[model samples]
Target: MSTEQTSPAPTLAEDDVDLIETTSDASLERTQRRSDAIEREIGEDPTRFRILTGDRPTGNLHLGHYFGSLLNRVRLQDAGVETWVLVADYQVITDRDGVGPIRERVLSLVADYLAVGIDPQRSTIFTHSAVPALNQLMLPFLSVVTDSELRRNPTVKSELEATGDRAMSGLMLTYPVHQAADILFCKANLVPVGKDQLPHLEQARVIARRFDERYGRAGDGSRPVFPRPEALLSNAPNVLGTDGQKMSKSRGNAIELGMDADTTAKLLKRAVTDADRHITYDPVLRPEVSNLVLLTALASGRRPEDVAAEIGDGGAATLKKAAIEAVNDMLAPVRARRAELAADEGYLLDVLRRGNEHANAVAEATLSEVRQAMHMVY
Candidate 1:
């Protein structure tokens, strides 16, 4: 989901507004763009690298997932570079409390990934719960990172104060450390993430670098063992919930995958729009209407501004009709593909097992190096 949607709404609670932290211009634009020369090089030789990224299976994915990361996942996988989709199942317990739904949610999430065109054969998709050794790496990895670093992470801070309770549970604070295990376990050379996730990735980089510096230097004084992995950033698409809030399951504002057309239409009917009752492209003035335009543009492969212009003076009603048509049209094919795949749970299981095996081979090799370096080898 886009950070824009998942962020705390403008109306803040007393606990949420604690101290009102801010960002400087330099940090604001960090990783917003990469050096053009490096981008060109990656495009010219994309297959020379591997990508690692994933989601915590807290809830079913939503429209925010589609425009932000799901679409990117499909595009990246189609590009022929090695990609891995991880289900951070344990991370689910960090902030959310709905353990009852987890088993169903994880299975549903597996279905959603398949439904959304994450080719199991092309991209490695596995659950964290199934991997014991990878989780074992977390205890050692935790030793290298300091507490201040954990407390200062912007994402962690945002997550902590998002609700009134201020959830800084050990699991929540140590999330980045767990995330480091997720990426480093795969021996991944690149992590595709949004700007908000850069801090978490920074922690991973720190751990990888620290481990190598302290342990990877051989008796002969060779270079560090870890890859010194780099972040391969992609522009995450902006999306909002029907209420013009950030799309999130917690806020009850998300449009989900696997929704039938009837349900989608009902939700879109209640979607927020401009007060002037006119459909226009001025996102600067009309975020609600513009969000609808964005939804259509993403679904139909047209520019959002162009979609607004096409609706002209007909107002939001016209735009809604057009948007619904475009969205349902897109959903029809995805639903059809998903139905076909749903007939075989056995196939999905095999795919995940194979992916785990491939992932485990790489992770085990890296962990072996780590153990040997730290003199922990059996």
Candidate 2:
């Protein structure tokens, strides 16, 4: 969802505040214009509007994933925007020392993309590891950014805290640079991101400008190598899991996209709630139950208070049953679609293989220009 919905732009610490405002005047204006154009063309010719978004194949995607990003990706694709979905397998190991079942997760990720309405004909779905050129691009990008700059990234800090790992891997430290490579590889000019990712996107803009100033100019003085990407901030609200924290796989509180009716009900029954006997939509006082209200509203396209009122005079158990029915109703189509897609392993493999070929060709072209710009083409 849009960062705006997530509370005001986070109060940046003095040191970090400047990083957010570091965009050059010219680049800021250019990005603003791009943002405006995207708004104007939402229902018009979106072929020119290129969007890049995807997920890390760490595990199966959950309901939180659907509300937060997967839904927006489909909207953008349906609007005729040129969309590219990346399965970021490379990012899976950045925090942990080792990982398992990556190949399985990648396949599952692709199935979810399809089941969620991401049309491969309209959007390029590819794997990160398939694009070797992205790694090459990351090498040069790392030099342009400093350790202090990387350390200041809020996402990295939060992730470190989440993992409770004192020692940060070199890969974890540099993933932002790698992310820049991903954006620039496809020359993606529009990114759908939440508020927390503002720093990472801003850093990518800095990297793009730095590369352009150093090597993007031709004899004609045109900087065509990369377009600084802009964030299309989502307005969707954050979705909490059954246990009342952020919905995540490791937390074991998430409701995966592939769950059936019985599974959805079981999870909702165990959702956290306060001791109050009455039903109300006081998110501040009863976040656990209100979270269920929010989920029902999102699923039914109604207001939370209205949903709370409809389930009048009931406690957490009443709310749980309502939420279960609403969620299962919403997920019925997605489950059926997922099941159909999962049955065809060969077709899924071909989809990725074809997408990989397309991605490799585009990456090679960008890498060639980058090598030439750096005078490494001898």
Per-candidate local distance difference test: 0.74, 0.82
The root-mean-square deviation over C-alpha atoms between each candidate and the true structure, in angstroms, is 8.6, 7.5
Error of 2 at 37 (Å): 6.5
How many residue pairs in model 1 have overlapping backbones?
A: 1
For candidate 1, give the lDDT: 0.74
TM-scores across all candidates?
0.87, 0.89
The digit string of per-residue lDDT tens for model 1 on 1-378 reads 121212222222331222122134464354444523335656788787677878877787888988888887887678766788898888888876645677667667777888888898889888887887788778877876667667777767787678667556788888888988988887777777765666777777777766664454423437555665566676766889888889988887677887788878878878889767556776677888999999988889998888988888888788888878888898887777666666677776777788788777777776777676666756
Per-candidate clashes, comma-separated: 1, 2
Candidate 1 lDDT score at position 162: 84
lDDT of 2 at 118: 91
lDDT of 2 by residue, 277-323 (tens): 67888888889889999999999889999999988778788888889
